[model samples]
Target: MGASGPAVLIAGPTASGKTALAVGLAAALGGEVINADSMQVYRELSILTARPTAAEMGGVPHHLFGHVAAGELYTVARWLADAEAALADVRARGRRPILVGGTGLYFSALVRGFSTVPAVPDAVRARWRERGAEIGPAGLHAILAERDPAMAARLRPTDPQRLLRALEVLEATGRSLADWQQETTRPLLGAGAWSGIVLTPDRTALRARIARRFAAMAAAGGLEEAARLDALGLDPVLPSMRAIGVPEMIAAARGDRSADDAVAAAITATRQYAKRQETWFRNQFSDWFRVDPLAGEGAALATALGHFGAGAGGAAG
Candidate 1:
């Protein structure tokens, strides 16, 4: 944004040490850590989200971390708007802005821009979620299939989140989400504005990391955090509820599943989600350079920071 400043993005799968990499990079690059994580945005579930601790941040400024109440809904549009404001303010301060997280959708929204669809209300959402189960997601997929077969064709019947959202846009606004997306398309950061590094550890390593991290997290307050949020009883359809281990953990903590079963389910879910992220990155974030931390974590950080430095003087792409 200025003649000189850094706006860097560090992205990767869970347990890839993205938070440490981000903080270290931000500290080294004279940057503030701006959260790009979807779950970390919620105030009530820090441990479960693996949000950077205050001590971990090491006196560096962090923005949009635990700023929103969990009960409140968040959307890509709102996050984009918030990110826009944060970037402006960070640029004004003449400090680098380091964006980091594992939320692929958040990263995609930042790099490719997002549609500004209006808030889909709770009553409407409740009805849809209820209907989604009763009619089955396949039934909803059939409905979406009639409206926009192209989008529906790609979605699996079991992706209730996608199905519900597609239907919500159609029923609530009488316009398909795809149509709204087309009209609201905006370039992310104009053109060639920033640089990014995606931490791409080996597949086996990444899976082990996800599993081990979840296990450590479960020991280190993730279950408590999830239970606390679960007790709040917010809309079950909310995005946070579907966070990789939240549901399974919640059920496990409540004795619905054995601890072993819960762990396996969570790990399986996370790995599956990571696959989705990988596919998304391949398809959408084809421009980013990949960094394999397995080689050397420090080297990966250096490469990421170097990209930021290179792109700081250029306009956003």
Candidate 2:
């Protein structure tokens, strides 16, 4: 551990047992868990986002999970600030902080820092949102490809929220989103202050877990949650609305698709999202310790404990 001590960062694809491992580590090290997942911040997205339940937390304190409303825009900057505060609070109490989730960008921003993009004018933002609503994500992505090819090449066409953001930034500042990202500020955690791990569970096993998890979600009131969110009549392009299972489950709730079909679609979408997450982790976290949770949770836990020089009955550092 450096002068700042060691905080554990656990990142992995969805359904990779990150939550369980985080809880286990927190319980062992007298630490608290801070959420890094983008969707899990929404209060209405518990089931679909696979947020840990109270029982799953095992009496270890968890922060920033389900703290924001679904209709609110929760940006990476906001999450970074919240996480920093949570980390400080944990350290102030002489407890380790364990940040865990599948959101690679969150981890990236925390470790590598992020530039604060100038806020777009309200009119400019509304205009881009209106265009997004009219053209849809694919059409918006096409427009981005024309205006900012470099940024477009980096973003997925199916992601409307990011597309709208990129278009708004370009129109508002006359610069590409990629250019803004390159002007990074100081990171929250300096080098050697934190130990990071990326879980790389076997794809076959992860896919099966995703399918089973979605099935469990559907049985555990996921449809009701989706219907409730849909009833709010929020913008479809909102981040919460774009969560993995929301669209399919909303369609099922509205009778546009059968429940079974919706579940299948949601499961497929989740698997695709997991693949993207895995790719991002592989590319961006190449230097971090890698653990395959599919092998055994004990081995993964042991590796993490080794990093902090902590035992099951001791605190990290």
Candidate 3:
């Protein structure tokens, strides 16, 4: 990434104002923001993903936000590739790069290196897809349990995609997915090249914020956005289709659920997702700087700047 200063990483649970903090940091440091969130990658899911609006971006350059189509498949490998290019470009332009998101895996891959799992052949993948469709996710997971018990035990029975992937990898290479994950390469963001922080708000306050923010999203044409995405007839297996609010909104749009009920379900789902994210950050990023949002953004900004050192306030691009 050239001879640039250390990059900044801002991670937190959903609805914890990660984007706002990212923008503020970028403004303070003359940095460009790069998205590390999975949901924010899809172009059709701005409202549901809570992606930053232009006004909220506040003139700082933002990359890898809403760049992928809903129907496209976006894997972590692809994200790493895109992120590496973005980081290099930002550094080459003499601007600090600030990566922000709730996706723990993205940060993990960036800082701790990504596993080089071999690609399953298309024929094998298609065969598994057919078998999964015929037997259902539970049945496929049962088969996975028989073939690769260690991998199967790690996956939920209801998660057909992972179950199928594990099954295909086992059949194709005779090795479990877990086995492949152990052999990882060098991290993209080497030591001394980056700084990271996790924002943790009070659980009660964060829950309240999640509920309120989701309600605001619904009121701000989130349902319409969901409906438009649904109309595209994308496969349910696509990562974009699995966005938190999309399924509930789709049910409401199809008359299978009331709009109010759908909104409630979506909010509950978001809260649950946020809780999982919080736990992940607690366990996985315990070493990074942790800020309590209850302490206010001023305090959080101070901590981030302190961690980033003298280059925290660089010239704007």
Please name the candidate that would achieve the greatest TM-score relative to the true structure.
2
**Runs of candidate 2 exceeding 4 Å displacement:** 1-4, 310-317
Model 1 clashes, total count: 8
RMSD to native, candidate 1: 2.4
Using TM-score as the measure, what is the rank order of every candidate, best first? 2, 3, 1
The C-alpha local distance difference test score for the whole of candidate 2 amounts to 0.89
Please, what is the TM-score per model? 0.90, 0.94, 0.93
For residue 254, model 3's alpha carbon misses the true position, in angstroms, by: 1.2
Could you tell me the TM-score of candidate 3? Answer: 0.93
In candidate 2 the C-alpha lDDT for residue 269 amounts to: 95
Q: Considering summed lDDT, which 10 consecutive residues are worst modelled in model 1? A: 308-317
lDDT of each residue in 106-213, candidate 2, tens digit only: 989988898899999999989989988888999999999999999999899988989999999999999999999999979898775777888999999999999999
State each model's CA lDDT, in order.
0.79, 0.89, 0.86
Question: How many angstroms is residue 190 displaced in model 1 relative to the true structure, after the best TM-score fit?
Answer: 2.0
